[model samples]
Target: MAEWLIEEGIGESRAILVEDGAIVEAAIELPGALRPGAVLAARLAAILIPGRRGIARFEDGSEALVEPLRGTLAEGAAIRAEIVREPIPEPGRPKPAKCIVTEAPLRPAPTLRERIGKSSIHPPVGPDRFEEAGWSELLEEAASGEIAFPGGALRMSLTPAMTLFDVDGALPPAELAIAGARACARAIRRFSIGGSIGIDLPTVPSKAARQAAAEAIDALLPQPFERTAVNGFGFLQIVRRRERASIPELVQWDQAGAAARALLRRAERAPGAGPRTISAAPPVISVLGRNPEWLEELGRRIGAQVRLRPDPALAIAAGDVQSAHS
Candidate 1:
């Protein structure tokens, strides 16, 4: 039976669904994000489209794009809104968080544990259950946007419009299409990716081959998603409800922060226990420095002092944790 294994790590929380000793789905939740389902008290900042859409400024000064505004709601008028989607980070400008006017009481966003519920298993800190289940490998895939499967590979790219996957390999066209479609479907689920998605499979002239490719996606991906039929160009489009940021979006948005959090996770499990030293790039060190509380919690959990060493030569993702005496 599939089970969710959760790790409440420093600065972030991670969960993976494991079946047959392999991960099928993964999710990571970072702190302080305005997650979906959070109802907030806000004032109408501006009406971008009269009686339809506008920007709402929350109490914290954070703003979200709100829609379906009532005709009577004027600028600076107080109203309640429920977040529908977290802010999407794009190249130049980030798309603001999306919300709809609501009468729901203002409430804090749900934490990962709260969202996942009590049924998920939370493993003790000593053993790295996440690592054993290929957590690092999954992160690499999210960072690089490359996923390999049996016959082919999918190169994922995040764009302002949609997330796209381009399939490539040495397999025959028909076989590659089927395999790629399946792999793309799995990648979408594994990464908790949603919103609009496009997949480019190897072009197979035969209609039967195209049908097989489409069916492969149907077999792997669950419901609550709509997908277009594979066109002659072997392109398929999928649309899923997007709530929070996907793993790729989170990892890529703040590379240094991601590295720092990942290093802290390793530091928590680092053996020997005299003192833990994290040697990382300057930006990663800066991220850790900003979150002194996270470091303090790590020290408390491990019963040892934690230190940071910034090495300019080290890559952000290549940070290492070591015992002082080792």
Candidate 2:
């Protein structure tokens, strides 16, 4: 049976799904997730498709496209809306979100993680109940892009449109394809990589061989995924439903933001704290500097003042949370 272990920290939350003592799927919610069912006030930013589609800006610097059920809307108009889809960050483009205009704030819907936690089938476990489950090591591998399996390896790369997994090793093409397919499925679920995915396997000349490879993948990958058959060039395409950005994207496009949230999580978890301070690179500090609410909440949670110090010499994404007196 699969069990969910949820850890709710200041500014963020993490839910890990463990089955047979191994993590299979993980979901993380960051600050300003803009998750579906969240009601927020938004100002119409622009008329993209004239009346059909328009962009709206939220107070938290997030933007979503608004589609009213009825009535005319114009630029700079204030509207209460419910998030339909969370914003997705695009390379060199604005983060895009979608919403439906509402006259009043509707009751928020349950998030995916929340629903999973409350499921009678997989109830959530206590916080830190599975700290020894090697989650850090697994996440480290997922972020690194290189995953090794029994007979082959997967080189995962993220692109603006889709994620690519290239299989490589000295094993026989058929054997390597089978092992690589299973590994790719595991990586996709473990890292929570969503949206478009492409897997490049070793070329198998025979039609039967290729079919076997595809079957191997089908057996391992779960439902709700649309995939194409392996082509002559050994390229397979799979599309998964995406609501939120994957772990790699969060770490890639928003290193400073991720580090700052991580710092706050660390500071809030510190024990026997008189006062705790986070020291990070200037960019990280600057990112956190924009939000004082997190610090204020930390003080209330820990019953101590919290501070952030910027160090020019520190590397990006490198930060320390320590006693203020240290």
Candidate 3:
């Protein structure tokens, strides 16, 4: 049976689905996750290029796009809207969550926890299994560029438009392609990778060989996906629904943001109510310095002052929390 391991961390919630002793699905819910099916009372913010894209401002100062809704919306006019899609995190930008004008607006926005409870997946119960399976190590591996399979390896690259995978190893062309396809599918599902994906396999000479490779891919990837057959150039494209940003996108491009978040999470779990100091790389410290709300929350939660120290030589992802002596 597949088991759910949900951890409510400081600034985020993480879920891992373990099946057959392996993590198959992993999801991270950040603070900004806006659940689908949520209705809100919003005001029209702008009508840029009217009839195509208009922006709405929610009560909490969050904004969503009102597009192709069939009528002119005067700027700053009040409107009721429902979120058809959840807000996805983009690097250093607001989530472009899609909303449609609704006659009935939900009073309170549904939170991530509430949505997870209502998901097809059952509510989490019993002891945690995340640390038992060394999930942190797995997370590190997923963020890395190169991932290894049995005989070959896959190099994953994240592009602005799509994610790319290059398959290369010592195995034969057909065998290597099959193995790579299976591995790629597994990686895609495990990391919750979405959007356009292109896999470059070793050039196969015959049509039958390419067909076989495509079959292997089809057999592995789950439903609700569209894929193109392997072309003569040994390239295949697969498109998956992009509900939210991929794990790599959340971690790789924003190391400083991750570091700042890590500092806050660590502080939340720190021992005692004493003042604490966080030491991290200069960039990480700068991120925290710029955002005093994080520290203010930490102070409110622990009832103590928090200090940040910059270590010029520390790695961007590394951080240490220490208690003040006095």
Candidate 4:
């Protein structure tokens, strides 16, 4: 699996999808390489997805798709992406239009926004208990209206060291270990990985050791699946892939934006001291927008009750781009 780092951070942000590489038609940015400091966007409360059927329309209509996602964010964090495009579209289809996308931070967690899934496992699965084996496979499902991918099985994993996945060039891998890794991380994204991952796997691994190492990469990168450095013993430390890019791409960005506003606006109206329950509870709510009043307006626009909080201001910021499952 692979992890990205956003160089700048996003503040009061939202994603803008560009289409045919122009504003007339919008498209959302997908992730490729991310810096360490700007990885927080994936951890934010909501992500907007632009579905296959509505890519151009979503932007042309500016009708954001309201798909719930699993992430949390502050304001002014810039979301950047490094995508590996498929050289060709379907056999009979016209070539895809070149596209450019960007994300702008929103106000502090929007008071009213769509509810993504909640944190399934909190405090995380520790490193010492790696061998206990009581962990259930992460099954994808809906915490609310939004759905989680790779939910059929294989939950996300986490490791202490940063994982550096060497994607041969800038393209998606098609094999199982690589495919599964890309698929998993693109679906569930709960844990953080460290260290540069070097992929030396051949098109086929003749030895068991080589095969296991590949498996370990897939297993150890997602949430709940926690571990440290893969020991040199050659035994792979396989785990679930990091879940991301599902709801983001499944729905239209406009729809997702509206839902996010609705969710946050409700939260902004909340009379309680802490956050409210949305299908499940999120650690924090993201009120991403450029203006505090706009965020407040968003909350007020919603009938629900939650107090809105302001985010610290910053001159330069960046957000994280999500990896896609498809």
Q: Which candidate's lDDT is highest?
A: 1
- Against the true structure, candidate 2 has what lDDT? 0.76
Comparing 1 with 2 on TM-score, the higher-scoring candidate is 1
lDDT of each: 0.89, 0.76, 0.77, 0.27
Instruction: Candidate 4: list runs displaced more than 4 Å.
Output: 1-11, 16-152, 163-179, 185-262, 265-295, 299-326
* TM-score, one value per model: 0.96, 0.82, 0.81, 0.23
Question: For model 2, how does the per-residue alpha-carbon lDDT over 6-88 read when each residue is reduced to its tens digit?
Answer: 66666667777888888888777775647877888778888877668888888877788777533477788888888876776
Off by over 4 Å in 1: none
For model 3 the local lDDT of residue 50 reads 71
Tens digits of per-residue lDDT, candidate 1, 261-305, equal 999888887767589999999999999999999999999988999
Report lDDT (Cα) of residue 192, candidate 4. Answer: 21
Q: Model 3 segments beyond 4 Å from truth?
A: 33-35, 85-95, 107-113, 117-128, 263-277, 289-307, 322-326
lDDT, residue 326, model 4: 14
Evaluate residue 269 in candidate 2 and report its C-alpha lDDT on the 0 to 100 scale. 61
Clashing pairs in 1: none
Question: What are the per-model numbers of colliding residue pairs?
Answer: 0, 0, 0, 118
Q: Rank the candidates by lDDT, best first.
A: 1, 3, 2, 4
Q: Compared with the true structure, what per-residue lDDT tens digits does model 4 show for residues 1-326?
A: 11111111012212211223211111112222221112112211123442221121121222111222113423222332211121111224422321122353422221111211221211111331111211111111111222232312222222122222222322222343344444434333322221222222224333444455456555644435643332343222333332222232222222333334334423333343332333211112242433355444443444333333332331111111111111
Q: Worst lDDT window (10 residues) for model 1?
A: 118-127
lDDT of 3: 0.77
Residue 41 lDDT (model 4): 24
